[model samples]
Target: MVPFSLTAAHGSIHASTKQVGCQPLASKGLNHTEQQAGEFRSSRRLVLLLGIASASSLQRPASATPYKEAENIQYGLSNGNIRPCPGGYNPNCVSTASLNDLYSPVWRSSLTSIATSAQVLDSAVMQSSDKAQIVIKRSMPNAEYLEYEVPGLFGRDFMEFLIKADKGAGGAGEENSEGAIVLYRSIAGNVKYLYPFQTAISDFGAQRKRLEAIRQTLGWRKLGCDLKECFE
Candidate 1:
């Protein structure tokens, strides 16, 4: 290759015309002032790099809400969910049933069919080389329930989705609309924590984010589980 430029033995930069770079300060010794100036510029670049790295490290992280101790977590259709979506004794779970914004925002089904909803869920959970696996699925008269083993950074969560096909007229929140709603609840099934060293490694608000990921997969908007699905 042709030389873009060459340095003179006397002392000068060897670089492309577009930019000036490289110092032969060591190869050909320079005056004390010139050497100090070069050192100062190098030090400035180093400091700038370190400052950027420090800022990134200090940025606020996603707050994780942890359930330190194991609590009474209930599941299944027969196990008394008299009032579904209620906050349980444990903090590791997030539900469409809770009033807290941290847990209330529901994924809109957007007139998607119950069967299609199931398929979407199946697809979402099945995409990442089997990252999310359905462990159990059952269907009743108007609803379908599916349980999934969703893996997280620290552990896996046992997530359940109760997808209900509402007629919207006969007490489905409206007198003449029709749509579907999915009630989600997840518990830290096997959260790994190193005791006192890492006592809390439960739900770091991952439940909603997981659902949100599925929402994007299904192309659904955010809504309250109580609100009727109106978009076609």
Candidate 2:
């Protein structure tokens, strides 16, 4: 028979091993719970991030209207004699006058004289004599509107000039005073994809320079001039 002490020691060793194995299983269960908690935290963080993005999008302001849609719409002329182009953008047009500044009143002259001078200036600077044509001339009690067409490679560019007498500053009332407000817009022709480049090449600096030369020729002082690019 085996010794009693030896048998009892063997039993104790077996029990200790069983307890050690059972401890591992308990640890595995705790680890599984921790992994589940970690997954839950990640999911919650994702939800928060999505919620923030949605809120930010909702809080953003609406975009401004496009120029084409708003170009025909006119605004009341202010003392500055300039107004923002509808929608604040025009891809086909550029101007050397701004709506931001109060332009100095210039001495008023006859519309016929101004138009003649403009035509002469345009003919002198244009690439071809036949390319420029005066299309419209209208006169109001206070303002004169003149539009010119310049043929381009793809289409015809249009220029509109507005010359208005300052309030009570010209004509019979103020014969000696010759100050007037002048505004002009050079619009590109209707050729898709090439309109911007055409406008830039045909107008931009070239048109502005011609206008300045005309202003100097007419003995008008520069008030405030600006160049605005068309929004693509």
Candidate 3:
């Protein structure tokens, strides 16, 4: 008795050796043993070529995909007064205060003065802000947190301002008032896959420049050393 069965196989074999000057054994006139040796060499060459192609593909950079603004999700600030690194530490996050030495200090001013400056910033941001949509406000006993969204290439970027009116260590009114800001670039969907660490660093530089311009426009003084020293 004979048994019959049907099965389907699916696979792909990329024969790139031919493109690299490798010749087929069947087309050459040779003895059986010579032909076998040639075939083995050809197989080895094909395997090597396939391996190279795979490595190159993996090393290739990722590309940014189209972004849909409607799909973005914005998170609200945490409860309580403003603290150092309100939303915690993130690689894509930058803040005015030093958080675990990860963030750099921004211009420090009085809460009242900063509040006045915020009005100007709000107006400027409202008029020329990139992809900004939502704004959330929170007031605590000694501080305030203002969070907003800015349009990003792939997803929405978060911008936050923290204002503190507590007294300084010396109990002096001069240092009681302080303000800070932070920017968080959100990488979502295809953007994360396409943009590498280098691209993210570039984005951070550009955003810092924009923020610096705003700070200058408000006539805010830099509290720490040079901005360049803040970067890691």
Which has the greatest TM-score? 1
Candidates in order: C-alpha RMSD to true structure: 18.2, 17.7, 11.9
Score every model by TM-score: 0.53, 0.41, 0.45
Superior candidate under TM-score, 1 versus 3: 1
Tell me the TM-score of model 2: 0.41
- lDDT at 25, model 1: 53
> Model 2: residues >4 Å from true position, as ranges?
1-89, 96-129, 168-176, 191-206, 216-219, 224-232
For residue 169, what is the lDDT in candidate 3?
A: 31
Clashes of each: 0, 6, 2
lDDT of 1 at 188: 65
Q: How far off is residue 111 in model 1, in Å?
A: 3.8
C-alpha lDDT values of all predictions: 0.58, 0.48, 0.46
lDDT of 2 by residue, 1-232 (tens): 2345444545655565455445654565657666567556655655565565555546456554342443344433345344433213334444534443212223223333444544444444353335578777666555656667776443666666666555555455342244455666655544233354422232334334444455555544443322231100
Evaluated at residue 162, the lDDT of candidate 1 is: 76
lDDT of 1 by residue, 1-232 (tens): 1121211311222123112225455564777687677667755655565565556556586553344334334566554231233243345567766666436454556564676677777777677336778888887656678888878655667777777654453654332234566677766665555555545454667766676666667766665434344221
Instruction: Give the lDDT ranking, best first.
Output: 1, 2, 3
Better structure of 2 and 3 per TM-score = 3
Taking all chains together, the TM-score of candidate 3 against the true structure is: 0.45
Minimum summed lDDT over a 10-residue window in model 3 is located at: 1-10
